[model samples]
Target chain A: MTLWLSMLGEALQAMSANKLRTFLTALGIIIGAGAVVLMVALGQGTQTAVTKSISALGSNLLIVRSGSAQQGGFRGGAGGLPTLKTSDAQALLDLTSLNTAAPVVQQGAQLVYGPNNWGTQIVGSTDAYLDIRDWTLQSGRPFTDTEMNSGMRVAILGQTVAEQLFGSADPIDQSVRIQKSPYQVIGVLAQKGQSMAGSDQDDTVLIPLVTAQRQLVGSQFKGTVSMIMAKANSAQQLASGEAQIADLLRQRHRIAEGADDDFSVTNMASIASTMAQITGMLSILLGSIAGISLLVGGIGIMNIMMVSVTERTREIGIRMAIGASRKTVLLQFLLEAVIITTTGGLIGILIGVGAALGVQRFGGIAVAITPQPILLAFGVSTLVGLFFGLYPARKASMMKPIEALRYQ
Target chain B: MSDIIRLAAIKKVYDTDAGPVPVLNGLELSIAPGEFVTIMGPSGSGKSTLMNILGCLDTPTSGEYWLDGENVASLDEDRLAEVRSRVLGFVFQGFNLLPRIDLKANVALPLVYQCVAKAKRLQRAITVLERVGLARQVNSLPPKISGGQQQRVAIARALVTQPRVILADEPTGNLDTVTGQEIMTLFQDINKESGVTMIVVTHDARVAHYARRLVYLRDGLITYDGSAADFQEALA
Candidate 1:
């Protein structure tokens, strides 16, 4: 071990004698490691952001959307099918397996507050909408059951809509007009920002289902519901809940057992797990692509080492002639290669952590730079140097002492 | 006197495309400890090949060669390296000091292969460098020192291992006459002080005169093996 230390010391002295050459040789390894770290960080950051957005919708929840019909040819969009009705939501809510349920209807129109006008989506839902969406109003409460039943004119403004219509001023009890229909703004929801799908949660209005069905949209859209959302009692029971709801809806609609159910239901936990799996695969793919660059870096180390062998042929002969074994000569060069790569790997990891932190600070996403990947990067780099450095070191060691000594 | 090295019926043949060529053919010789010997020959007279064999850098094709109480002729490469490190100290015509290392480090390099302790190796190296009159230049690199000084450092390196014998292959080949004579005087001092045997290979008759005995070779045969004075009288 002492001998190894001395040999390593000598090798380091030799490398240090040529600073620019050493630095340039190390550059390839640095870039390879840096790319690996940064790519993994980006992939992980995107996955985290995506997961947070999905988790915001609450666990154990499922959304059932109306499905399109297939014609004699292919299907396009919903295929102008008859819309879902409030009765379907009612039937699903009556099921004992469900936690809470709400039916939704949506319309987009120009909203006017004072002289300022902005186009915004207006959604119609029952009082159960707050429970299903996991939302709580920040100011005055959402309309009560009586208010929803009586079709009272009140509105809950989404954050962005509130900002556009009322600025800093509280919109509670203020009035906003939609399509010439004036309504009292009852509350402004807490900022929910945007969903994973990039839709602005704060850019919409919420009102009672009956009022939106009658006043703004008219009878032609009566009995037409866009979607139904409900929570299961627990994630374990979600599948049973979905099955029960599907059977109930089929019976209510009087559809046959073998026929297509004309609807689709997705559990939130399953969606989140699936998204995480896809993201993890993406991270690995990107990391492997960066690994190719590391391979190239290994080749670069080999190239430089071959040149070093040629340049130091006389030195090798001197050492060998002085009593250095072939293994000693081989190990000296291998140690040099490993030192360069391992140091480069460490520096690259530091840079990666710093970059991830910067992205978290600026991008407002929870980007975690874990130690496992950093260690992995470093380990891979040293192995690369050792593996690729072997051939050149072997070539150097195999040289005849006489030939090496005579080499000019 | 103890016979430190012996060669009996040794032969070294090289295969050429044209034919086989013999460098050393059935040579027999012996040398005792604490003796100074020089091998002299003209160019291509196989003197360097004989030096290589004597230094344990090359083995005879067929021989019963013994060195320092061991049969070194049949030893493998690694064993030969071991013999070279433990039994022999070597100086080269080119003054082969590793340019990257300092004088002290170069002198200490052999002990590293021998697995000597760092502190002891450094101490021994410093002592040998001082013995070679290079104590003040211990930290200097080979290129930074004069040609005579570099040869001194090489001598220190060869002597620092404190082997039984020093094998110098044309030690003064690259030095001027004054530098070369000074180097020979230093070698004589080392041999006289340490009581170690020295074998120098040289074509120059003046360099050979520094040795107490000279072995003359021509066409792979020893033509004369006697005192330098006897050869000088014969030439005159």
Candidate 2:
């Protein structure tokens, strides 16, 4: 232990004598480690942000959308595509397999609440939409089934739309116009913020499906309902619900065997799994890119170490000829390399984590500084030093004692 | 007197670009434990080669070289280094004290190689330096001192190991007459007081005068071997 400490002291003294060169040599490694950690943090941050947004849409909700083709071939199967209708939703609701089922119609239009006008989406659905969206009325009551069935000219505004329309005034019972059609706002939804897809949930307005179908468009036969929403009783029952829904939808659409279904059913469990997989993959991709910089830094360490070996050739010879074994010499140089690179790696990890914290603290997005990536970068940095240091240490140890004594 | 060193018919050859050149040929010598001997010869007379062989830095091509009854010629390179560390000390003409380290560290180097404890090695180094009248210069570096002082430090380094013999290769070759005499008097004092056998290689008669015995070599062969009085008589 004392000998090793003396060796380390000597190495540090030697490096201190040439401070600028040593710092410059270590700079590459620092940047490499820092970049690796930064990439991982950013990747993890993005994934977390995306996952948080997706989870906000409620856990047990599954969405079914129209497939690419239609059974009737109307409008070249673009508009008349095979879709989930009101009947499919009712059927799922009536079954003991599902918890809740709702049909939806979506329309993008310019909304005018008093003098303030904004481009927003208007959704038409039953009262069950609030549960699927994880929303509650902020102040007033929600729309009733009577309104939904009778196609009443009553509306429910999302938090953002209500704020813009009414400001501090109560938006409930106030009137808002959707494309020249004035409707009384019966309720205001709680702020649900943004979805995982970057769409603002609070920036929308909702009304009865029949009102939207009758007053907004006069019911032109375009296709099946836009989408369907349903829920399973529990997470464990999700798979069974999915299987039952798929079978029921398949039978209702009456597709023959070997024919691909014309509709897509997206279960919440599967959607969450798919999204998590994508986030994980993206995180790894980004982390690997950072890993490349560390590799470059390792190469830099090796290159500079080679130069150091050449410069200290006589010193190496003097030590070896005195009684230092080849292994001793090799270890000395390797230790020096490891010392420089590991220090750089440690500093880089700190900087990466610090930067990640800074982003999290100041920036609106959440930043994740995971320990696994930091440790991975650190281990890789040491390996890089060892890998690069071997060649130079070998060269130093291979020098003949007599020739070393002869070297000026 | 105790016979401590012996060499029998030791020969060394170097293969150069020109061809093989023999440096030592059929040389036999021995030194008593407390003897002070001076080896004198011309530049190419192979005195340095003989010194290297005696120092255990190089091996003879053939013949038995023994120190204290151990045949050094049979020892491997690592064992040879061990022998050199424990039994033999070397002082080169260049005063090859490591300049990068301080005088104490340089002197402690051999002891370190011998795995001496730090405190004991340091204490012994100080004692040897004091013996050589270099006690005050213990903390100084090689280059920071004069040529004579550097050689004295080298001598202290050699003596710190408590070797049986000190090999001084042209000990005064790089010093002035007065400094050379001072160094010679130091060597004679250590030899008389500590009973350390000394072999000094020199070309100058004055430096050779300090040796109790003198050997003259010519063309890789010893031509005269006797007491200092006989060498003076032969020169006369």
Candidate 3:
């Protein structure tokens, strides 16, 4: 053990004596490790961002939209049949697995407050809409059920619309005109950022379904709804709740057996998993590319170690003559290689983390830096050193003492 | 004193593109412990080959060789290295000190292989360096000192192991006449004071005069082996 330690000391001394060469030799590993770290951080950050956006759509929620309708030989896309209704949403709430349900009516309208006017989505829903979508108010309160039933002109402004209409000023109790009809803004919704589909969730206004149907949408859409948003009791109940809703809707719609249903159920969990799969694959792809660079770094180490072995042939001979065994010589060179790579690995980690933080701070992109990948990179770099250092170290150890001593 | 090195009918052959080249042909020699002997020969006379075999750096192609009562001719590579470390120390013509490390570390190289503790190895190295009159140059690197000092450091490294024999191959070949004489004087003092067995291989007659016994090799055979004074008188 003492001999090994001394050999390690000798290796370190030799490396330090050629600081520039050592640093240059380790550069390949440094860049490789840095690239790996950055790519992983970005991948993790993107995954987190995607998950956040998906959850922002609502937790354990499902959306039921009217399915494509066939007219003669022409078939439309999903949500073209407009078969969903307020009664379907009401019946969906009766399921034990469902926490809440809201029938939705959506239209694009011009919202005007004073001199400012903005075109935005106007969604009409019941009081349960906020609870089902996991939305909270930034200020004031939701409209009463009496108001919804009475078709009163009250509105809840989303963060984007509120900013356009009121700026920093509070919009509560203020009057706004939606499609030429005056309405009182009851509350402002909290910032929801972007949805899973990459659309801004905060660029809309909410009003009671009856009010939208009676005042703006006209009587033609009185009984029907654009979609229904249903929340399951928990994440685990989503599939069963979706099944019960589907069975109930099929029966209520009086659809024939084995026929395509008039509505489509979209599970948010499924969308989330698919998105996670895509991002996970992307991370692996990036990680593999970075791994290739690490392999190149290992080759760089091998090349330099070969040169070192050749240059120090006489030194090795002297060591052998003085009593150093082949094992000692091999170990010394291996130690040098490991030290170089590990040092490079550590530096790479620092640079990678710094780059991640830099991207977060300056690029305005979310970056998650975890310990697992860092440790993995470190362990891989050490192994690379061991593997690449082997051939050169073996060559050094196999030198005959006489031939080595005679090396010029 | 018992014979520390015994070689009987030892032969070394090197395979080359031309054919097999025989260097040492059935050579026989023996040296008792505490004896200082010099082997002198011209280039290609197998003096270096004999030194290499004697130092366990290379094994004879076929022979019965005993070193310190062990049959070294048949020993494996690892055991040969072990024997080299424990029983023999070598000084080369070029000093062969690792230039990056300090004098003390260079002198302590043998003990590092022996797995000696750091403090004790340094202590022994310093003691030997002082014996070679290099006490003040312990912390200096080899290149920072003169060639004579570097050779002394080499000698100190050889002595630090307290080996049964010290083998030197043309120890003063790279030094000037005066430095060479100084190095030879140090070797003479070490041999006379400590009774350490020393075998120096050189072509210089003045260097060979430092040894008590002189052996002359020609055409892979020992032409003369006797006291240095007798060999000098015979040459005259």
Candidate 4:
């Protein structure tokens, strides 16, 4: 053990003597390790963000969209043409298996508050929209039932709309004109950042469903709504809730058996699973790139060590003559290689973490870094050193002292 | 006195693509403890091969060889390394000190292989360096010191292990005449004072005169082996 320690000391001395060369030799390893750490951080970070966005979408939601329109047998999947009614959403709330059902209608309009006017999406939903979305108000309160029933002109401003119109001032009790109609702002929704679709969630203005239906978007049909978003009692009930909704809607519509209903019910898990698959594949791709770079780094180490062993032939001779055994010489060179990779690994991890945080700060991307991946990166780099170093060290130890002494 | 080194019919040959070539043929020689012996010969006289064999760096092709009371001719590579560290100290013509290390580290090289504690070995190295008149240069790198001081550091390294036999191969070949004589005199003093055996190989007759005993080799055979004074007198 003492001998090994002393050998380590000597290896350090040799490395310190050629600091620039050592670092250059380890550059590939540095890049490889850095890529590995960054890949893990970004991969895990993206998954977390996806999950957060999914949950931010709603509480275990099953979204119901109107079926595709058939025009001369040319069907496009963009089928959001509003065939469901607000009555259907109200009827879904009768099912005990559901937590809440929010009927929604949407339109884009220019919102004007005094001298400030900004174009944004206007969401018309029942008060149950807040419960289904897990949404909280930053100020004031949700619209009352009598207000929604009477089609009163009360509104809740999304954070971005409030910020644009008020700029950190209290927006409650202020009046905003939507499509030239003045509505009093009753509440301001809390910040929700971006949704899973990468669209800004806070760039909206919310109004009661009946008010939007009567005054804003529902002039074509008597009681039409764009969609119904229903929440299940729990995750396990989502499938059954979807089935029950399908059966109940079919029966309500009085559609015959074997006929395609004009409405579609989708389980949110499928969306989540698809998102998970994309992120999982992304992590694997990033990991493979890192693995390939590590392989190249191992080769780089091997190449440099070969040159080092050849360059230090005379030194090996001197050591051998001074009673250094073959094993000792081999161990010495191997120790040097390991030290290089370990040092490079540490530097790479530092750079990766720094870059990850930089992305989080400047690029506005979420990145997660944990200890296990760091340890894995470090361990793999060390193993690469040992695996690649063995051949060159073996060559050094195999030299005969007489010929090595004569080496110039 | 029991001989510290024994060689009986030791033979070494090289297998070349041209054919086999014999280097040492049926050589027999021995020297007692505390004796200083120098082997003198011209180039290609098999003197270096004999030095390598004596230092345990190479084994003889055939025959029995004993070093410090142990049979080492048939020992494996690791055992030879062990024997080299425990019983032999070596000096080379070019003063083969590892240039990257300081005098203390160079002198402690053998003990490093022997697994000696760093502090103890370094302390012993400093003591031996002081004995070689290099106390002031103990921490100096080999390239920073003069050729003579470098050779002195090499000598200190050889003495650091305090081995039974110190083998020097043309120890003063790179030095000036004055520096050469000084190195030879240092070897003589070390042999006399420490009671350690000294075997030096040189082509210079003047350097050979420092040894109390002399062996002369020619064509892989010993031409003369006797006291240095009588060999010189007979040649004269």
Which candidate should be chosen as best, given lDDT against the real structure? 3
- Every candidate's DockQ is 0.63, 0.30, 0.76, 0.70
The number of the candidate with the highest TM-score is: 3
Model 1 over residues A141-180: C-alpha lDDT tens digits?
8898887988878899988998898888988888889888
Model 4 spans > 4 angstroms off: A42-51, A69-81, A94-97, A107-121, A148-153, A160-184, A196-200, A214-220
List candidate 2 stretches off by more than 4 Å: A53-62, A67-83, A93-100, A108-119, A126-156, A168-198, A207-224, A231-244, A256-262, A266-293, A320-322, A354-367, B16-19, B116-141
lDDT of model 2, residue A201: 81
TM-score of chain A of each: 0.85, 0.81, 0.95, 0.86
lDDT of 2 at B186: 91
Query: Could you tell me the lDDT of residue A33 within candidate 2?
Result: 90
Q: What is the TM-score of chain A in candidate 3?
A: 0.95
lDDT of all predictions: 0.85, 0.80, 0.91, 0.89
Give one digit per residue, the lDDT tens place, for model 3 in A1-408. Answer: 777788887788889978998998899889888878888888888988888788888889899998888778888998876788889998998999899999999989999999999999999999888997789999989989798989899999999999998999989999999888899999999999887667899999999998987877767667888999999999999999999999999999998899888899999989998899998888888878888898899999999999989999999999898888899999999999999999999998899899989999999988889887798789989999999999999999999988999999
Name the candidate, 1 or 2, with the larger lDDT value: 1
lDDT (Cα) of model 2: 0.80
Candidate 1 residues lying further than 4 Å off, grouped into runs, are: A54-61, A67-82, A94-97, A109-118, A175-186, A220-224, A233-244, A257-282, A352-368
Q: For model 4, what is the error of residue A339's alpha carbon versus the real structure, in angstroms, after optimal superposition?
A: 0.9
lDDT of 2 by residue, A213-330 (tens): 7766435533346788888888788888877888888889897888766666677777787878898898899888888888988888888888888877766655644555565567
